[model samples]
Target chain A: MSNYSLRHLQELEAESIFVIREVFAQFENPAILFSGGKDSIVLTHLAKKAFWPAKIPFPLVHIDTGHNFPETIDFRDKLVENLGARLVVGLVQDSIDQGKVAEETGLNASRNALQTTTLLDTIEANKFDAAMGGARRDEEKARAKERFFSHRDDFGQWDPKNQRPELWNIFNGKKNMGEHFRVFPISNWTEMDVWQYILAENIPLPSLYFAHEREVIERNGTLLAVSDYLNMRGDEVKMTKTVRYRTCGDMPITGAVESNASTLEDIIVEIAATRMTERGTRADDKRSETAMEDRKKQGYF
Target chain B: MTQSGYLDMELLRFTTAGSVDDGKSTLIGRLLYDSKSIFEDQLEAVKGSSQKKGLAHIDLSLLTDGLKDEREQGITIDVAYRYFATPRRKFIIADTPGHIQYTRNMVTGASTANLALILIDARKGVIEQTYRHSYIASLLQIPHIIVCVNKMDLVDYDQERFNEIVKTYEAFASKLDVQDIRFIPISALEGDNVVNRSTKTSWYEGSTLLHTLENIHIGSDYNHLDARFPIQTVIRPHRQEYHDFRGYAGRIDGGVFRPGEEIIVLPSGFKSKIKEIMVGEEKVSEAFPPMSVTMTLDDDIDVSRGDMLAKPNNQPDSTQDLELMMCWLNNRGLNPSSKYILRHTSNEMRTMVKEVIYKLNINSLSKDESDKNIGMNDIFRAKLRTTKAVLKDAYRKNRNTGSLILVDEATNETVAAGMIV
Candidate 1:
């Protein structure tokens, strides 16, 4: 037997780095989609490792929903500054203001879906041949069938049925003019894997991930953080709770779970012991059975 | 406890092949559910969908059929990946459809998998789909094969029926080139010999499917005897501190390399001694297969992407006339006169199909010498002449350096997957 066996996390890390390097080599212009989430944080860290002694070859693209937690934006800016990597923010507010996308109304309104338009427009404006995301197959049912180098048409639409067969480590990123690709470096990672990786790497994440005192309101059995983006409803009463977000997205739509897991080690334990998926608390996914699938078809990351 | 345990766990990626009626999705669903990998919300969603369909029992297949058209048609049209982990190992299942029409999808899924799970219905013993799947597994050179004889409960959990199916499969599998083959009688619906051992299967002495998957010896799955590193790209930081630092970055395909080892850069045939191997700022003494690292040479030998670094004594063949087993993946048929782009490792070059050897009949394990037309899902041996010489090994020797893909230049679609012979 060879004395070269790596731990599961190490193997996954190496695989992800290989994919990130491939994107750097294959595409003329590629950017890592940074949402300040744990997955994207790990991806950006991997990109740093992929070209160590050198800066990350690609810029970090953030499709700012404009409804994000202030802590997330602060963390995103700080990380970008620390790494000396460029940050490109595509604003959903700009898209709405420019009449490219209309804002949702009523109780469960969110700018989450509108970010796709800003994202596509940003890719077109920048002419990014590949936009790498931190999407994992274990995240959602619709994402399970996603390719590592997912292809997008000229309109940035995903055709799940006619996806190219990704064999071995050979990723085909070939596309015509005006078309682009969505490269997922960590497509094989599970939620548990991501947490375990964060713990192993000591990766810094946004403060929203850890337990904190925050004002929240319960809606549809989920605790929504009370922020400027959310309007107070008549029957919904706000309360203070020590909770942490399982996933980071728009403030109004992204839900938080009451937890005492403050440290990375504590968070890993909490995730391992939990029965609900990370996306289970997100109100946007509960809109329909194929909500994520529908959104991805329309170019949502 | 979870953190420490996760660090010791190994990862195993396996592919499953089964027809629509063979309960492939059910088997996967049972594995995930029994392992507690399925979240409560996911199960609740599946239950709601099942109620909407007015079905008495929850359709486990609905959990795997992800696409909208697939859900509407009640069949899996493409490959869907599923992940689950236990204390011992992490498992990634590449679930592919098993109809004769979707053989290309099966091949694609099996390409990266360490093991292939061939599902056979107990009622129908060994059928054509079984042969077809097994053949593809062998062609892809998957290291392990697990013949899962499912639906034993429908056959009254009869040991005799299971043994008969196992015997027929063994007879058929003997014709293939798979190294390790295990047979297990499972009832994916009743949860027999899948995750938990069944009392009804007490006569069987084998381990459960989950246990086998966890304990399988996969340490020697990679090619560690011959060192092969194809540079993905060069990392030249123009920073002031690292002005003179140049590193060739890529994942090691095979074997091990240590500092001061004499290595030869391929195609250029220039020799250099390794100065250091870096894995993200930390200097490692040695590097091996699948570990993406940066290597700095003692001498700058003009190495770039698509170039290889191997031990001076041990080297792969640098050849232009390549003979390989090709599985056509696109709807467009192979045109002998037209040129296609051949992508191997990090290298891409234009190539032409020189000759079409006999097409392999997957069902009968026979070669049809007369039918030279290679269409979608057709596996054939062919000679390809590339514009540039590529470093390669036989498909059976090293999978990473031995495999290549043909891309249709006009559409830029991956047309075929080739295994270098």
Candidate 2:
């Protein structure tokens, strides 16, 4: 027995780095599913560290829902440029234009679910055998049972019941020609862990996470940002409110919370004292009981 | 903001195995509730689901029963990960079900665990479930085993009953391979001996379950004596600054290695000196097991993934024949005639099952040599013949380097988890 020991964050970082290195070693064409969120940014940072001295051996794939917060897009492009990594954008609008996917009709509709079609199509087009996502198990129930190396059918649908058994640190990436695998390196990380790591590593994030003044409308007790992507036909009055986004997603579905935590330190304090789950404000998850599961079954990230 | 103290906290990963009646959910709920891990939205959602199901109170079991089918079927199918952190340490709970593919789920959960929490109903004493749970924990070589005797309230918090259960378990544990074992009487339902010291168990002198988990000495769990580094990938900058940079990247499976140390590359028998070990951009003096780092050698030698580096005097065996204790994980039985791909660490080789030594009946905790027909959730000792020599160690020696998994090529499914003899 030796006195040398690693902290929890270091251990997690090591595990994540190991998984990323495995992806680079095992898969033929792998890509990071970057959503411009804090999780994805942290994933990219870890991936960079995993193959330092050598560039990250995979492209960063962003499934563009065409309704993203402008800051997310700018930040994504800048980060990609700084990392010297290739960025592949899959547009949901392109799928809609090609009649491959139809847009939702009602006002509450979002391009969130439609990202599945574009994402699968992008994976198929790029011939990516493995798509690394930053989704944590603590986020959703169905995700809680996800294997670190998740297998998807040829149609890209995840069969939660029939996942391959992953043992120890050994991951089996073997799959059929058309079948792809979705690997989550940070499957064990919680939201607090992610925030702590981000702060510890001093990783850069989009400005939307910090508190700022924005015109938003109150709907179902949520502050919806007034943007072109969001509909304003309802009678809800729009007012300027200082809010910060917990999760970065499309404008219509991603809600903001009013807070004074503009810095990462203050955000951590707020998160520590906060009672609600980060995804509680997500309108997409509020749709149904098994919303994430339903979409994940249809090959959603 | 309060930050630096939490950074010093180490991680303690433990798996909890119990049946529905063992009150596993109650124990987990109490732990999370005491630590304030469950968020308000999560509880609200659970409450809403409980109301929708017409339940009078919140079903904490719903929180652990993950996936749509599991909720619908009223049983856990796979291992679900749950997290909670106290001021002293952070914990990851691999909450595995006791039945319905118990072997597969428990093995997956126990593979990375430092401890195993085997729950037993105080009223039931030592049942078959207890035997199965303890057996899996022992077989997986979990460093710590805490037999949590739940439902002590139901047994009137009797010390004699607890002592009797512990004696019965001790009789059974003699057959197991585990060493560090402890007992604690807990009433998860009544929060007795769970978080705080219970007044009912004034006769009990042991620490509470939460205290035990928080203060357990897990620093020595890793193998820091045998330096075994299996290369997962090669790092080549091919850039301007570091043009000739060629490094072997891997997580140390065992022991430690430092610069200027003599090492031998497996299969090639090429001797080289460790020039430097770099974790990301910074060079470290030494590296140990579970730390991912890139090491550069003095001599220019061809070393790639699946190759292992170790001290010349103390090296792992590279052999084509492998004898292992395998737990069949898939629905399909272990087919001796079927060609399977054996994955060990970063290495993969075509392998076939030569023979089945024996199958252990998990229920009775006895070996059944006559029953050679192996199926899912069946743990058996078998001989495997690989197409190429694999660098390996005994499972009890180095868990990272000594274990392997067999993948079914046709269906592309992981069929078995094997621990080397």
Candidate 3:
């Protein structure tokens, strides 16, 4: 008892709760940039703990690419209902329809990069002074240098070279009008930490992360789930296999891993021994060596 | 059994600071690389980068340089945080650069660190830069200081040279306020005493860097004498199950707070008794430093962010002015009259550096009272006046409430690291 301190999950929770409350206290209007993924779900869960007696004083803002998994959307709706928090979605379909953004045309076409424009636009339109995210530094190389409270200029550009010096737990969330900040509450957490925390906290996640029999096609050494978002090519063969997604993104780019790790315990064991990183399955990051860095520079959360 | 392995784990954050080209990055890289924390793909990426540069070997320093531009330039320009864990403890390494220009980065890295790892080149011995690093460590109230005499391979693992350098450092460090100091001689490039024991230097019997980190006596580092919990938010679930539950959610800043203990709120001077302490349904008997728990009082009292709850008899000094040892980090000089935001604990207030008392000559370990201009990479003592009164304690007494950072109002950049004197 005298030698006791917090575990990894508890420390992560404490640090994240501290970050979330700082965002709410510092920014005039802040929102959580939810992507309907496990990371975002964990962020929302931590936010719920941040302001317990009081409702989460901010809304869950999602930048919709209209290429999401239906199960993800279902999970989002149910979780939002359970927490009783407001949801704000910015539709890329509407941006395409309004001629705000043009849809890419190709076999490997994706709205992943286009979501940045919609996200910046949504942030500007809503006047969110601080936008909280679940981006972990250990997830990507560029994010490794990311500050907890990352400030953006009025033009919605991130200057990686000119970031604020974040010391201690003191986050300077000050920004002028038209300029805002992006806060990552779970910046220090790794993929394993997130899963372990989710399991420990009993946070409900989307069913896509669990094993299920689904028709999928193998392309570029990745198992792509068959959905309306993906048009099956002739060379691609579709078959049913027991698989669970290590990451959840749009159905087009997000890949599934061959695994029977359905339960949380199984998932933890699988992740503990897994060789590949969680982002290795996301084709969005593989588009280039610094795809995440490039998108982040243009204000992509 | 797998999830249960993380039942009781503590976190230790430490910083490594030294002069330029003292192999700070290599030491950290070796720690992570040898600990099996570096994944194969990450290692592959680093190896690929090293091969592209046409280096004879894989440059481990490339692992700590996070930014793309920094990697291309082959230097660490900012504070890059790296995480790893043994079964005993989790470690967060604030990998800071040692360049004179990046002094602000060092200050930022050392602000929240519990320990400071000061590296010394075996050839250079105790140079002027080593003194600067030690002074900053002492000023920051970093409880433990581990001075690693690196590059022993270059010195042929000479014990005489190690003894002479240790004596020189001890003579200089005696003037500072550092409480704990330990010395180890290692060759980081040869993987000596970083993660594994070195067979080359059998004379050194101290624990390796990893062993020292895992088994350091950190339980006494926290201030258990005075409990300080700053309320972060109010937690209330309006559902049927927790309809009437009102909890003050916060991270315990200092000391231990137990259930049913008599506590008093600051500024308001209101008193109450702790009704319950809840951390996710497991009712905790007591909460200490760094634990985030919600405490409901027996009586309803007004408490919000920046408000502190502490033992009634043991209270922090409420003051508007403080004397601080500040390390100027930015190229922009200190603004003596201009107001900047000061963040201490959960409280934020506007502050101004009223006077620069004296600047320390890092090389000589002497004070230069004539110098008043605080410039980049300069360590100086100054008086700061804040708009609002802050609950304060000596940095040596309570690290959480005693330290602060001065932010630039225009740029929102943290300009200086302040430790109450």
Candidate 4:
């Protein structure tokens, strides 16, 4: 056990820190795409350590769907205040109010897809050359081929086939004036690794992640929290299930799981034995097989 | 978590090179399925797709065929990284494409790999690709190579066919620089000797592919004798408690560093003592390769990003002239007069291609000294003249310090990956 090699979690952490610092050094302006999810929470914590004692240099850009769970908003505000980092909010509600995007009117209607417009507009408005995200490759098939430093056109579109070949530790962040980059520091991390690192580092997370009694509607075999943003339809009876969200996304799109994993240790054990990928719980992905790949091309985080 | 031995699990990154027809993706899918890494929902999606496409059996390759175009064409055009873990180790498989874009994709995948899986059809004893792939693996200095003589089911699990292919590969690979080479007979499509011991190959005594991957000694893959830290950025908090804290933040490229160790900064050639290695505010007594840490120096010298700190006695070479074996990635051919931005570790300097020594005919495993026109997928040896001296080691000696990439000034795309000779 007296070896110098690092465990998988440690190695992943180091690689992520290196990438964060590279974003700071390579781009004129870079902001973290924080979604108040477990993945983004871990990413922000790593940024804090990446430049110890120095507050995170870049601001956190949240593409608020305006349909978020109150817990996620509250958690986001508190974390930002604690880190003394700046928070930039891009409201999809604003996009709707300005007649920029139309809301879908259907049973599976969600503001999840509208976040792309807000996100792209936010990046352009802020003139951010790079947006560091918490996206992991193992989450979906399209992401499995994503580069750590992914390129984006001026329109903030992802060209999977036309990406620059990333080699070794060197990241190429160079682009035209109008073009930008979407950097995924945690591209190599898996769902299990994220939970493991969170436990090992004692990183604080949103309480919504812990099992709690909540009013939810079981639709399509997945639990959706009953929030003001989501109204139950006929025969979509509300069930007071002790559930925790596997992913922190928009209220209508995110799905919850039946669990009693209130403690971090319990959560890790639950995740280890689980037979589902984290993104599998996401309702938006069920719309189509290429749902994620399509949104990613249109600049969805 | 600790009771499950999760804490002790190490990481291993490997590359797989073979076309779809050779069952490369099928092998990866088998590994994931047997390891329980493939989730139920994902399997269901694959099953649904298989049914819609009228596939007789579940097409496992669909799982790795990611992008829309790739899925439509039933081919992989880029290197898709796949993850699977057993209890013993976490595996990151760089499933490199084996199509027309072979060399560039394989080089990118092999750069950080500890082992490479070169597939050979049992029926096709030794093909041109076997030589090309094995050469690239050796050129990149990958530590281990597993020649998976696949489709044993097609060959009736004949040990003689597998043995013949193994001997042919060994004779060709002997001319290369790789150290550890092994052979395995398996049928990735039929789930034989991939994750489980195959009774079909009763004459084979070697371990299964998964077993070898789990048990391979990868601790020595990193260079531990030389401590080289290239400063990525300067972490100057300027806070009240640590007003004068000037920590050099970087990942150790090689070896280890501890407090009270004497070191020297490159280019400036300034001497300093290791004050402490800080992970955050807390101090770590020792730091090693791939671990990013902030270190302070006892002596207050001018140190910034792109600066290297190494033991004075064991320093790397620094010179304006460099020799490198580079793989051209961009579509535009190499122009000798054009200057490219060469990035080595944390250092970036403008450099010009002084001369092209030779272009490698990978399929033939020969050097084409007369082919100076380096095009895409071409690996060529060349001399570079840097604007400033760079601290470097041979790629074979240390991958971290020895490797670099060239960025086109106009396109800004990474055009070439260079391995110092």
Candidate 5:
């Protein structure tokens, strides 16, 4: 008998750590895809705990689109240095320069989709049979059906219909040569779980997460951070507003919510009260109902 | 409160097993639906799919057929996971298929389940699929078995039919190793004795499915006698501020771990004393099964992946030869001479099947001794010889140390699941 009760966050952390250990034991060559977001950061922390007394055996892979928040870059570098783990950055810009992928050109163009080419190339080059990601099932519709050990074909396409059955704690990370598995140890975790885990762990994150005074413009009910990447219409007036990002992605696309939740506990409370999902704040997902699914099929993590 | 009440909320993972039309999906859908965990959009989508299929009402089976092919074929092909939470506890539901060819899926789903929800249509009493599911649940050592008599409304809510099915199931279940057996008459379509007790069934005394699920005793599911923590990785934050920090991170596979306890790491045969148990700092004094934490030891020892830690006095057997019941999943038959990767808990190693003792006839629950080769969805008892010694116990004794999965190297598919004897 004990005096303490396991909170919701503790349960989720335990489950995620259990899954991470399973991945480490099952896969030959596995890597954690670190995007420096809160979810990925929480994943890294869990991975660290999954293998205590020994360093994380797998390297951290960052699919760098070259267009990233400077704060995210700083967070990534600091975390990698402190953990004493290897970092492998698959540069989308390099892939474009190398002619492996063609860059998209448009008014609202971004390198989000092009990251898939570099990611697939990196997996092939490094022979990463299993790539652990921070993808949560509650984030989107298509992701809800994703298995823990998501199989990818030779072309790096996700065939949702042919996914293998994953039951219990047994994750099948088996793939033929030229094929790979996208492992989501946090498949059962939701956004609230991630935030609560972060709060409990006291894990550090980029400044973009907390409320800060920044120049922003309201566009289609979304607060877009005023950056050089954005094409400001004359009617869309920019004003300095205290806002915090719900999800950190490309600076040109990710939206900021009108928030004053500077602390982890505050963030958790705010998220609990919010009605819309986290992806609702991102402009990229707003492009189409199946935007995330379409990008995921092309091997974008 | 009693001492047991301290651990009131125990995790209950269960599998729903039944043939194609036994209302397995409907039962699961009803469970999730009544729990209020089904999102509105998901419900709407399922309703849309049902309407498109020309059904007069929402087909609850549409919830479990997640895959496109399964939806198109109007049958469950693979095991789908569903989660729901009630005030008492959270539930992880493994919705497994019931086709004879999908026997492996049932075994996989039931492998870690604490309960087995074996649905039997009141009209079809104790069929082969029911026997197969119940037998496999017993083989897997699922702590609880609830033989749900589904579609009771179809049989005009007949208590006689329910009683006959229970008697037939009990007679057969007596031959198998089952701890707790329960029966409930449910109308998944009409929602009787599922979420709310049915008014029509005044003769029934047992609680509803949801009520039983929320109150089932799952505290004894874990083997508290054995302490097993397979080391997944080592954490040494090399910064100057935390230069002396050294913690072993892994989930507690079995038993309880506390600070100041003496422990020995397996394979390396190194002894160490636990200095602190940290769950992301605020050092914990104790930890138990399924809790993930970092522990700093008194001395630095050589502990790496595939190695397990336990109390020095009570150690698991380190043996190469293990007898187990294996269920093959892939289309390709087992390569008798080929080496495969066998994963147990966090330990993985190359192993080979020494002999196929006997394949269980899933339909008839009979043993076929003449068969030497095991193919897809074949459940067989066999002896396995691993390249390295594994610390193991009977599946019934300790699920953490007793269960394993065999991976096919050539195809890179999880070919089979095995239970240590």
Candidate 6:
């Protein structure tokens, strides 16, 4: 009569590790979609744990929007180099230069939407049958219905209505020649779970997650970080404030919130007491109600 | 606000099956809203969408109806996962649609659920949907079943009506193989007995829905008697510092494993002693069910992916012939004679259906032996022969090691989900 049971975080970690291993076993070529965000950082950590004593079997694929925080790029390169893992960069600017996708115009313009083209192109060029992402269902509405082994059509489109029924721990990643899968090992994790796991494991993350004094402008009730990518309008005045990002995205569109939560413990506490969703401050999601869903349908991670 | 104890909270995953009319979405919405799991921004978004659609009240269903087609059609087309947490436990709700045609979806959701939540309308007591869902829950071997008699307000919060419905369900459920069953009467829309106790239901002396969910005994849900670990992959660093490091990586499906325990690798029948168990960076004294860890054996035995490790005295059946109850998931009908990919645990092999013995009628709970044509959403018992032998247990014992899915080779789509008998 063994009475052994795993706690929620441990169980979630085990499940994710299991999924990560399954991806390696089932697919000939797979990669972790590294965005330098906390979620992706945790994912890369899990992948490393999944195949301990061994280098992560797959490369880390990052879709660089060219509008990222300099700290994020540095963190990405350092982590990849330390782990001795290959890093694949899918540049949205390259896609624009190649005339595959045009850059958006006017204020609030970002390379966020154009990453889909570059991402798909990278997947095709590399022939990656499975691309593991750090997307969690609790992060957005569209993600709530996502499968652990989410199937994609040859055209890189997601048909939500006709998804194959996934059951138990058995995920069917079998696909045709041109088709691929978008696998999310952390689909069951919530934002709080991710933070708690990070704190428990002492996983290193980009410095953007902690409070820092940075130049920012308040636009439409959101604190936009003043960076080289942003074309600051005359009305938007820049000022210095202590703020931290709840989510990491393009520097021009990703908004930060004023906070003193510098440590992981403080961030977890701040989130616990927060009434707003993490993506509420993200200007990209604020563009429309189904912004995430629309972007996901177009093959954006 | 402290982070120390939050990681120790247990996880409870439950599935809810009910049609749109039964207020399934509303019940889930209420659970999220009243528990403070629903963020203000999410609530505001739902409110804006509700107002756009000319709704007098905030339609909570809009919170879960995610897809454009589902929103336009006003129904849940697939299983949508929802997460919430209390101080005591974290919950994952696999919200499955309840229309009869979507029986496959319900089965998919119930497959991994620790508990099955079947909502019954107080106005229409013990309907076909209730029986169908209960039967499906029983068939899937979900350990616990909580029958929520919803809309008690419409029935004037009558205790007698709730009791009558419970009696009908109990009598019907007695025919099924359900282990633990509980009843809760509540009005999802009125927020009575869902999260908070209601004055209207003062006659009822039971825990609220939230209380029942938080306090369910789920410690003994897993099979800890038999030790089973199916290796998903082999971890080999090959670095000069840690040369000759060969660790088998997989999640423990059943029982408890400790360092120095004697175990045998399956299929090849190689005996080895457990040297160490590593869960991430730390070394653990013991590993149990659902814990993924890398284990190194004392002897340099040859072990690869799709292999199983178990106590020599207690071993699973290794055979090519299997008897299984399968739910057809795809739109295409079953081709019994054609070869299909049968994936069990981490092992995959080609399999062919030898015979379709019978089809189980979910609503009637009867077997139709004559009809062998299995179509979408059909549950049937069949004989399968795999090209390679598989290590498996009965589905009633261990779900992780006892289930397999059949995929069509041509299209590479999962066509059926099977449970070993």
Candidate 3 clashes between residue pairs 3 or more apart in a chain or in different chains: A52-B235, A52-B236, A53-B235, A53-B236, A54-B236, B104-B329
lDDT of 1 by residue, A1-301 (tens): 5466777887888899999999999899999999988889989999999999999989999998888899999999999999999999998889999999999998899998898899999999999999999999998889999999999999999989778999999989898999999999999999889898887777889999999999999988889998888967898999999999999988998889999999998998898889999889888888887899999999989
**Per-residue alpha-carbon lDDT of candidate 3 for residues B137-195, written as tens digits (9 for 90 to 100):** 77777899999999999999999999999999999988888889999999889999898
- lDDT for each residue of candidate 6 in B1-421, tens digit (9 for 90 to 100): 1212346689999999999999999999999999999899999989998899999999877777777778878888889999999999999999999988999999999999999999999999999899999988988999999999999999999999999999999999999888999999999999999999999999999999999999999999998989999999888888997798889999999888999999999999999899999986678888888989999999998999889999999999999999999999989999977899999998889999999999998888899999999999999999999999999999999998999999999888889999999
lDDT of 6 at B256: 88
Cα lDDT, model 4, residue B132: 82
Q: What does DockQ give for each predicted structure?
A: 0.67, 0.67, 0.50, 0.64, 0.27, 0.67
Q: List the residue pairs that clash in candidate 2.
A: none
DockQ class, candidate 4? medium
The estimated TM-scores of all candidates read: 0.98, 0.98, 0.94, 0.98, 0.84, 0.98
lDDT of 2 by residue, A176-294 (tens): 88999999999989898999888887889999999999999988888899988887666779899999999998899889999999889999999989988889989999888898999
Estimate the TM-score for candidate 2.
0.98
TM-score of chain A of each: 0.98, 0.98, 0.98, 0.98, 0.94, 0.98
Which tens-of-lDDT digit does each residue in A6-57 have in candidate 6?
A: 7898889989999999999989999999999999999999998888878899
lDDT of 1 by residue, B204-280 (tens): 99999999999998889999999999999999999999998999999999999999999999989999999999989
Local error of candidate 2 at B28, Å?
1.3
Q: In model 4, what lDDT does residue B343 have?
A: 95
Per-residue alpha-carbon lDDT of candidate 2 for residues B14-68, written as tens digits (9 for 90 to 100):
9998888889987898888777888888888888888999999777766676777
Please write out the lDDT profile of model 5 over residues B304-352, one tens digit for every residue. Answer: 7678889998888899999998788788899899999988876778999
Candidate 3 ranges with C-alpha deviation above 4 Å: A231-234, B1-6, B18-20, B235-246, B280-282, B410-412
Span of ten consecutive residues with least summed lDDT in model 6 chain B: B1-10
lDDT of candidate 4 at residue A202, scale 0 to 100: 88
lDDT values of the candidates? 0.91, 0.90, 0.84, 0.90, 0.80, 0.92
Task: Name the Cα RMSD for model 1.
Answer: 1.6
